[model samples]
Target: MSAGDIILIPNRSDNYIYLLRCAKSGVTAVIDPGDAAPVIDELEKRGWQLDIILNTHHHNDHVGGNAELKEKYGAKIIGPTAEADKIGGLDVTVAEGDTVKVGELEASIYDVPGHTAGHIAFYFPAVSALFSGDSLFALGCGRLFEGTAEQMWHSLIKFRTLPVETRLYCGHEYTLNNARFALTIEPENTALQARVSAIETLRKANRPTIPSTIGEEIDTNPFLRADVPLVGKAMGMSGATAEIVFTEIRHRKDNF
Candidate 1:
């Protein structure tokens, strides 16, 4: 495996569980295990020992395999402290601004509460990677499950402030659906149109759409580009603030 190689394990049809392996150290840390079988298979295939399991939220699709993996590999279960009650067998509950290490890589946790009121994204500044679990998706954002629109907006903005080259590793494979809705808000964005076509092709091939970069998302993602004037006009909410328009767009997607 390449150094710092990310292996994506497709789970539950739409969800993705990732394994981050340090090629130099032979250490592996998994990010969200929705199922145990696939993770186990991957680990066994490589004869790797899981050092840590990172959980962004308590959602079953994110933490379902925690107990089993922790038991089998003796991996440390790291979860968000804000939703301690939701996570099982959490050995270390972290909060925003806290740092966790995966081999030589250091992940800085951000409290991005919206999808689950305690959802956190891990930022590896050195690698320019963000593990956004159900919070941000390509051409989309997570539903307002336990957070207000304003709160979610703020959380997303926090990510926007990161380096534009940062890579985003989201939890689910929702690119096709998100890309469809993106056109409603950004009809003038030919980049969005082209990206949507690419995503559609990937979906038809049953390939996972993930590991998108912040720059690409900024260019084509409607949710992340609510500040664009054309997007605001397309939403039928002219003269409205970007935040207001973004909320409306999110609502429309929620009901769709």
Candidate 2:
């Protein structure tokens, strides 16, 4: 029932590896360990044993270290039920509404299929944190790799329903580029303009612009602002349905 310590590990290019450690129980879990060397090294450095390997999808970059980590630490592997066969060393398959526990921390699983048909997210209500994988990002959303714009929109809507204080930990460090693209969609949005400025400063210092709060994304992320009048007007789709506006924005991003 307590919040955990999260270690953000920058992995292979733009990917991220999150190491969650329960402060109360000293239990540790590796979320999306695309590479095992760093996770293993960090675990040893902290004298923490790996107890869980949690995957949001079966993408190679996300699960590439699954087998090695599981075999090395005897950690139980958990992944999306829809992608169980595709993910290596999976011991448990979960879907929306299911729950996973890491020591005293309990996280709710969410089916956020869009980046991939079986993509999912993990939400730790106790910590007000969401491991959104690649489904949602700062100032942007994942591409419809195996799903449609409508599906991605629905997935985003599901995330938006979480508490505004919920902080999202996305899979990639694409915020700088996403912020630039978002400006094109909502150039007049003051929140977005300010966020872009802040993002530039952070990136210049090589800092991560992640763990963005739902409230911040709601106010600044173009992908999440499709329903706003200004966003719709910019796309020449004023009064358009959220789905339609989202689709247009997604399409434009594909070309952007």
Candidate 3:
């Protein structure tokens, strides 16, 4: 169970499609393919056959390419059991505490419902990577479309418990905008300020500001810091509970 090699492929608008290959068994998988063309092109370029399609939620952009990829390569589609009806073509449906294997690599599933109820994340401890589709982002969490702020906060708490070094492979490229919005929340945070500068540089160079570690997010991401007293004070809600503070943060972000 060696660390796998993960490739980030940008897709429609800001969606991200990750292609991962197990170092030990050469198993290839695509995570949240928003479109089939880009995934197919990348697979052809690398001359690797797609072995599995791993989806996190039922969003159209997340599972859009499932049928085409499965049809072309006979790949198995593994997605969240809660969203089984919405996410068609799932050969294997998994829930929280379930384990999924890709060749010699294994991933633990976590139920992280926020942007969508029943959304799940895949954590490959062997590689210290979390393919967090739409639940947690670089400096923000996904919008609470079908779930509550409390639910999103709890979901983020699950992410916070992971090892700080875990590399977060989120589903979108919204770091730049998220950074700006985060600054509005914590104007004097030195770490957040420094991260903003770095994010600006990366976007200017047309580079992805992804794979942000959990430690980095914990330091600069306001969404993850809702439980901290400083964050509550900054929001003018001193001594508020984490859930109340988190709800305010989400409300501001929704309007930001």
Candidate 4:
């Protein structure tokens, strides 16, 4: 169930669209394509045809190429039904509790509405992979663009329930900036300090810091790890549950 080669096609300066290829199955899916040209280029270069187009939300940057790709390649476009009106050519409009298929592989759908009122994340249980569109990132969660802090908290909590090994594939490349903000909340977290060091190197080399695992994010990402007692205490909120601490950290990041 391991991913074969995850390709990163940099777009829009800092934005990146990732393509996942399964080795044994040759099943391929594009995650949050901001533009059609790069996706078309990559597929043509590999002599591959896109089988599925998985979207996290309906932002232009995320779904800009969805319509083109669907028409050109006949790829199945799967997105949250709550935004079905905006998710162009949506073949399968899903909600929480629904399961979507990519070839023989199945990804469980979660209605993670925080960044947008209808944002959805795809979690492939067999491969331990989660495709979280704009809703979640490496060290941060998306801003409260269309939902409340409480809604975002609930979405984050759902991801917290995933197995520690689940590998998370989010929609953007905002780790470096996110880590800086995280430091303001939990400056002493050793795990975060180490990740900061590693990510700095990755950034310096102009590499993409993505496909972050649920366990790795849980240990280092303040938005997801605020449940740790030490973290809860750092925010000047004693005895608050981890989710509450998590909520506070998100609020701070929003304004930071």
TM-score per model over all chains: 0.95, 0.97, 0.98, 0.92
State the lDDT of candidate 1 residue by residue for 1-256, as single tens digits.
Answer: 3348788888887899999876677678999998888999999998888999999999998999999999999999999999999898999999998999888788899998888899999998766789999898888899988998778877887888888898899998888888888887777888888898888888899887788889888898877777778777777777888779778888889877
Q: What local lDDT does model 1 show for residue 6?
A: 81
Candidate 1 Cα deviation (angstroms), residue 91: 0.8
TM-score of 2: 0.97
Compare the candidates by TM-score and give the number of the best one. Answer: 3
Pairs in clash, predicted candidate 2 = none
* Cα distance off (Å), candidate 1, residue 255: 2.1
Give the clash count for each candidate: 0, 0, 0, 1
Descending-lDDT candidate ranking: 3, 2, 1, 4
Tell me the whole-model lDDT of each prediction, alpha carbons only. Answer: 0.87, 0.90, 0.94, 0.84
In terms of lDDT, model 1 sits at: 0.87
Candidate 4 residue runs with Cα over 4 Å from true position: 1-5, 22-25, 241-244
Q: For residues 36-110, could you state the per-residue lDDT of candidate 3 as single tens digits?
A: 999999999988999999999999999999999999999999999999999888999999989999888899999
Name the regions of candidate 3 deviating beyond 4 angstroms: none
The sequence of per-residue lDDT tens digits that candidate 4 reaches over residues 176-209 is 9998888887899888889988889999998889
